[model samples]
Target: MSNERLLIIDDDVALCNLLSDYLGHEGYRVEASHSAEAALQRLADDDVWDLLILDIQMPGASGLELLQQLRPRLRTPVIMLTGRGDEIDRILGLEMGADDYLGKPCNPRELLARVRAVLRRAGPDAVVEPRLFPEQVIERSGLRLDPGLREVSVDGEALELTSAEFNVLAYLMQNAGRVMSKEQLTELVLHRKLTAYDRALDVHVSRVRQKLAPLVGDGVELIKTIRGQGYQFVKGSA
Candidate 1:
């Protein structure tokens, strides 16, 4: 049995208990909190959780608020639970640093898959494309990508990027100057298909751009939108 520890924060008591039981059976050490405040307290006391399953809507303190409070201090991978058809909550959760999201009333099987995928991506065992192993270190413009180490540095300064962002950036850089469609990127980086009206890939790309801007400088587009085509990493633009 796996020893991965997971913390689920939601206001739904029965749901929490159900998940705790179900996820426990899936070989994860699952802990549940019915309130965001209690979750925060638990996090403060012990921040060693492998992953966090957060609900977007909760009583007392919303999930977004808790996320805003947690992100700056923690780098834990988060998978948000959003209401079905609630696009805003899903987008907001992603923007707030959630690693992944699933609509509420989600299938436990799907949730387990997402959980495994996120954990695998975040873990040291994450797989990289074999093509990228030619040198294990790729440099473009002034940015250096070390696939083996899963690190990216700009002008010799390392930038902190989430696993999802790192994977997206790596794919872009690997195919610099080529337009990678949202469908392709979503499948390759997120290990999922691009659903209609899904903004997950866009949000991740936006986050990558946002994080790179401060290090790359303003007005210089490192990743450019292709106007309905997709995104291309600009080459020769430091």
Candidate 2:
């Protein structure tokens, strides 16, 4: 694990140092930058980073701005840090390509856990054994999915998908033409039991819908919402 490099970008020098020391102790080669400029320089150097810890509020360039620029070039899994209890910031971060978001004054252990989870999901090593969907590429209603590569395309164009978004698409593809309830999707796709009124699945579904917007208005709704039930994949097309 020590071989895996993590970059910490935050203007809070004390917090950055503390995180570097702690994450280093936990078997990660951690690097810290007090400004977005330094962070970009480190990123441009082509150093292989397994994960990124980015703070939302910074002096020169905001973390969100850096993330917007980095998304096009960086593939490192990012866990964003927002101000204390800023729910809107957290949600915005996730929508802006962050793998996860943590509030300020966070627990170190919890942050470490989130880092491990994001790495596991984003890493190629996440899928160890042969998967049923391995090497399987499915195309239905102009929705193209390649599970082996964790990619989805609409109308032959690549779609930007978060890990959860990809999981939702994969689940729908696997159960093409079958309606799946939110509970089932939350459990099966997310690998966790669903609690009452958990709307994360809905949020991810909306994101996927945005990615598949090009397929809309073509008599082929890739995902069909069943009024009382959940969603079903419209099978048999591109």
Candidate number achieving the greatest lDDT relative to the actual structure: 1
Model 2: how far residue 50 lies from native, Å: 0.4
lDDT of 1 by residue, 6-109 (tens): 99999888888888888899899999988899998999899999999999899889998788666424667899999889998787677556889999897888
Candidate 2 lDDT over residue span 124-176, tens digit each: 76533223232478877667787656677777888888766777788788778
lDDT of the candidates, in the order given:
0.83, 0.77
- Cα-based lDDT at residue 198, candidate 1: 91
Residue 136 of model 1, lDDT score: 59
For candidate 1, the TM-score is: 0.55
Where does candidate 1 stray beyond 4 Å?
Answer: 126-238
Q: Which stretches of candidate 2 lie over 4 Å from their true place?
A: 126-238
Clashing pairs in 2: none
- TM-score: model 2 vs. ground truth: 0.55
- In angstroms, the error of model 1 at 151 is 29
Candidate 2, residue 204: CA error in Å?
12
Compute the lDDT for candidate 2: 0.77
